[model samples]
Target: MASSPFLNEVRTSIRVRGMSIRTEKTYIYWIRFFIRYNHCRHPTEMGAAEVVDFLGHLATERNVAVNTQRIALNALAYLYNQFLKQPLGDLES
Candidate 1:
């Protein structure tokens, strides 16, 4: 499948910041997962509630380790705070 323009924009943002290739890939993967998890909704249409739900799902349903959950959170944090310029301030997860 073709990549979404939004993901491309993310790659551009990552590169501009001199982030490592692995970090770029990881962030993209998690962002894509987040989008898909929310039924492909645009990130701008969602906020902290969705983020909290997703992370909770990771911890409870998926049984992911704390570090894994933290990584996902970091990815989403960057997606909002840096890329979208809509900070999800103090998400409760």
Candidate 2:
């Protein structure tokens, strides 16, 4: 898969701002899964349905704990809010 430009931007900003490595890793993981959940489509082209699908996969398919799922969601939300500057209020399940 091609490296996502959006993910690159997010990583760059996080590194430049001196974010913790854990935070950077978590954000990248979420963004990568988000992309795959939408069939490798760009996040800019995805909507609440895609987000919901990804979260559902985490909860049901992956059997992640509630807190873990929430953390992933928060990571993705940060990417949406900070990197893309896209409003995520409408994406809430």
Q: Write the per-residue lDDT of candidate 1 for residues 1-93, one digit (tens) a residue.
A: 578998999999999999999999999999999999999999999999999999999999999999999999999999999999999998865
Which runs in model 2 stand beyond 4 Å of their true positions? 1-3, 90-93
Per-residue error for 89 in candidate 2, Å, reads: 0.5
Clashing pairs for model 1 are none
lDDT of 2 at 93: 50
Q: How do the residues 2-82 of candidate 2 rate in per-residue lDDT, one tens digit apiece?
A: 566778888898898798999898888888887877778888887567777888999999999999888888887877777
lDDT of 2 at 63: 97
Best by TM-score: 1
Candidate 1 ranges with C-alpha deviation above 4 Å: none
RMSD values, in order shown:
1.1, 2.2
